[model samples]
Target: MEQSQIQNHNLEKKRRRVLNKPLRLRCSVQNYNWGILGNKSHVARLFSLNSGSHIDPDESYAELWIGTHESGPSFVDDQFDCLNSLKEWISKNPDVLGDQVLKKWGGELPFLFKVLSIKKALSIQAHPDKELARALHKSQPSLYKDDNHKPELALALTEFEALCGFISLKNWLGGADAEQWLPVNEMDKNHELEAVLESIFSQILLSSKDKICQSLSKLKWRLNLEKKKRQLTDKEKLVLRLEGQYPADAGVIAAFLLNYVKLNRGEALCIGANEPHAYIYGECIECMATSDNVVRAGLTSKHRDIQTLLSMLKRRQGFPEILQGLSLNQYTTRYLPPFEEFEVDRCILPEAASVVFPSVPGPSLLLFISGNGTIGASVPEEQMVEEGDILFLPAYMEFTITSESKELHLYRAGVNSSFFQAY
Candidate 1:
């Protein structure tokens, strides 16, 4: 080979060696006020496991973030070569995101993967769509930090409760499964119902403080009487629980406006753009577009953006669909939403067994939910991974893992397969 050609070939060979290797990432933990307390928190436990540091019994650990988001950026584990941050690493090696992903997101990770330990009701809020997100960011950069839409999915790690979307008033109010909330006039039945929901939701947000207080008091009194006659329903109980957290707060009333859904382990909920939702309690795996934009109406001491949130919210009402995984292989199940940003795969390996994940279109983030195992591109150079461990897998790199426990469970977050198929 010619001298210059040989040098180019050698450089390209070195690049491949660095790009395909799995990198252990020390992810960031968020200590938000509403998080689980001390050693009881999964976030805290995972942080402790990652750093070999003692978990404080009193601190609130809300989230363990495993991505390149600016709010909770991860870093390359020190056992390997030291790196500044996950974001920095991605910027330096843009091809690690894959050609399609790199071109779409400009050297950024499109999805932010998280583990949330919710002890209280989160803010009653909605995420704007892409166009509105851009407008919101341009108008109020301090509040809406990014110009990206956040369509998130949550997979239950335990028993999880959340208020998602609006409830079907026709069924809940009129007790008519196939009837309308209001008498059908000239308009379409669905559109008519949507208008009613929109009107009621608007009134709820626009209610005056004194009016809110009186409504809350009357509702409490009625609930007390109802409880004397019979046990309160779960939705009714949720209202009382939230009242203790934020006395007479607007979010307490939100229970009536939104659908109360409970998810058992392995089930998932997809929160699309403009859908109103709040995580009530329990631990879950959350993945979304990389953005920190939230338009909160209540249940927070922070500023409320009622008008903005109202403008962006969907008025349709019905029970949202619960997602179950489809088997991808003998050891893996995948959950894919109708979105282009991301998808997740759950992998389970029996004790003393092994499986190889086929090469995927883009880089992915993996979290070991339980069990200890060895993972790598190949066996001899494998690294040990236990519960709470996080690893970054590069694009087009086939990965192999072997379980050392009774059963191993882990979730992998990656770009949508459709993105690659299009290319």
Candidate 2:
């Protein structure tokens, strides 16, 4: 063969080597302070079960990462070069990323898949859009890791609650919340909706630490009273809960400003880039772009970019759209957000049942949340799969899963098919 043809042959061989089999993976675990402690954390339970590693009962188990993101990369269990992370594997065989993703994001994966077991509220934060992310990364490389924007979807694994976007103008300045949000009404007596919100939020952002502590004490005292406790709205109750977790923090009081969203199991909410939101409580499956850049304002001791967060936030009011997922088959329901970065699917198979996942144009990660099954790939090979297991499937690979004793629940993470349609 000629030199050019020889290079093509070798590249094709590398692609076939990676695409022919499923990779059983061991993912990284993050222990954030806001996570559930010990065995109570779903992240811990799954990580220990999957890796056979010791679980620290006193330590918090926060996030189980299942991707090639540098923050917490996954490792292949069955491969001989087990020391190399999935990130390294992808670098060797970039063709595994598929044409659409490889063309757009180069050698890196475009999305990060995670299981978050939250026991307390995460930082009241917002992610920047592409333009702002690029600027921030250029100016502050240490703080902002990547130029990629982080637009995430939070799917409730259990009953999940969060502070998302701003509440309606009427809700903030009238009715049951009028007394609690008295300052907002006082600050913006003459301004329109967005102006009123800006003035209120700006004041909160600029408040003295002493004043915030004092306000939190007063709010708690009032809510603890017999009369107020009985009539506490969902937002008010969340305020009290957040105050309990983060005493004297402004985010506790921010409950009155942001919409309190309650998502039941299997429901999802997508927070676009530059939207101000926080995960308040409960367990969830979170998927987003592979970047770890977050601009925080309050609710934690993390670094704050108050000015950047304030400037980037979208002031739109009203609750976020709740996605119940579209049913693709008897066993699968897909929660594909409007963002092109990610598409998540929930699959449940009853005892002695099977489900076929068609070939995809991009790489994918399959998380077995519960039960046991056997996964059959192309040809006559079968692999045993169990609860807490994670499998990485390369591009253009199809597989069928059959549940054994009980119902099998799993989450499949993939890129949106629209990216490949052009190719």
Candidate 3:
């Protein structure tokens, strides 16, 4: 071959390689008692994936971890080659990520991804903002970091319930019931109480337990009351009983806590950092920034960084609001959050459906939650997909899904300008 022809052929091959190469990743599940992805045990199990523990068959399940975070690197080859810890990988590979992602997030993967199954409530806690996380990590190298900020979104695999954000202060101040005095609501309307709580948190940071008893004393009084018979539902009764057991549970006083949102199979909710939340029950397809930095206040026996958590807690009150309103298209409904880390969409196909995704330059994660279907990519042959199966789609690839059963439900994860703009 002529030298010029050889050079042109080499350049064409390199271009094809760059265009077809994508960073999409899939995670293998670990085990847990509730074995589903949403249990407390599952949280530990999920961490085990990174910790390199044996997958406990007695109590374990698995989940895929996608995104550019460094804590848990995805297995890139048969021998499990780890990427440059997640942070370092992004720094070293700017040419691969390009200017779009780098401009918005400095070449770091802006989000974490996971599939969680919850059999119980997570901790009743919140997350520190980026500034606070950095400061805490600096003062005590053991406790915090810039990447510990956890803003999460969960789409239900089964019905799901979680306490998210704070209820509006107006909701608490409107009533003067025994429930209102609960610790979670003590600062509901009174700016003094908020200030006092804040002060106590700062003091606790210095290891002073001076006001701990006083805070718990007032909280216990409100929690010891007998169940009210004034027309409260069964769930309300159970919450009050829990308050009785742990009067210090600020979750009890938040009437918003009494609000049990029933998310059907495909619904979703986004919980931001420093937003007090607890997943009650049921299974969910959860995705978040890939960090396990949780500061708990109550509801579980996990480590509780009381002072740090209190400092991070947003004192504002009201029922937790769902972020990124749900948008419905002909065959899909999307829950778009204000953050760029993750975006989820649920597609319901009756009989058969065809979707032509737009050409975008980012990887995508797709899960077939229910029914059966065939997914066709650039290749002429179609791949059969079923409930619980997941597919990773590379950038700039167009795909179509056709249902073979009565109904096919699917979830898609991708990046769009809308997510970046919201942030």
- TM-scores for all candidates: the values are 0.91, 0.93, 0.70
Which candidate, 2 or 3, has the higher TM-score? 2
Superposed by TM-score, candidate 1 places the C-alpha of residue 126 at a distance from the truth, in angstroms, of 0.3
RMSD of each: 4.4, 3.3, 6.2
Show where candidate 2 strays beyond 4 Å.
1-18, 185-187, 226-230
Q: Model 1 misses residue 145 by how many Å?
A: 1.1
Off by over 4 Å in 3: 1-25, 30-64, 68-72, 76-98, 139-148, 173-235, 240-262, 323-328, 379-381, 419-423
lDDT of 3 by residue, 297-398 (tens): 665555667767755777654455554336566887787776666677778898877765554565566766568878877655777777645545555677
Q: Model 2, 1-423: lDDT tens per residue?
A: 899999989877755654677888889999999999999999999999888988999999999999987778899775454787888878877888788789888888889999999998999999999999999999999999989899999999999988889888887657575546434545477777676776677678767799898888777777778355477777767777787788877777766788889999999999999888999888999999888899998898888788898889898898889999999999999998877888999999999999999999899999999999899987578989998999888888889999995799999999976667656
Scanning candidate 2 in windows of ten residues, the lowest lDDT window is 178-187
1-423 per-residue lDDT for model 1 (tens digits): 999999989877765666667878888889889999988887888888876778888888999999988888999874334666888878878888888898888889999999999998899999999999999999999998989999999999899999999888675665421112122234333466557666666676677877777767877787788889988777778888887898867667755768889999999999999998889999999999898889999787888999999888897789999999889888998999888889999888999889888888689999998899888783248788899788888788898889999999999999988778888
**Any runs in candidate 1 off by more than 4 Å, and if so which?**
1-16, 78-81, 175-191, 378-380
Tally clashing residue pairs in candidate 1. Answer: 0
TM-score of 3: 0.70
Rate residue 351 of model 2 by lDDT.
98
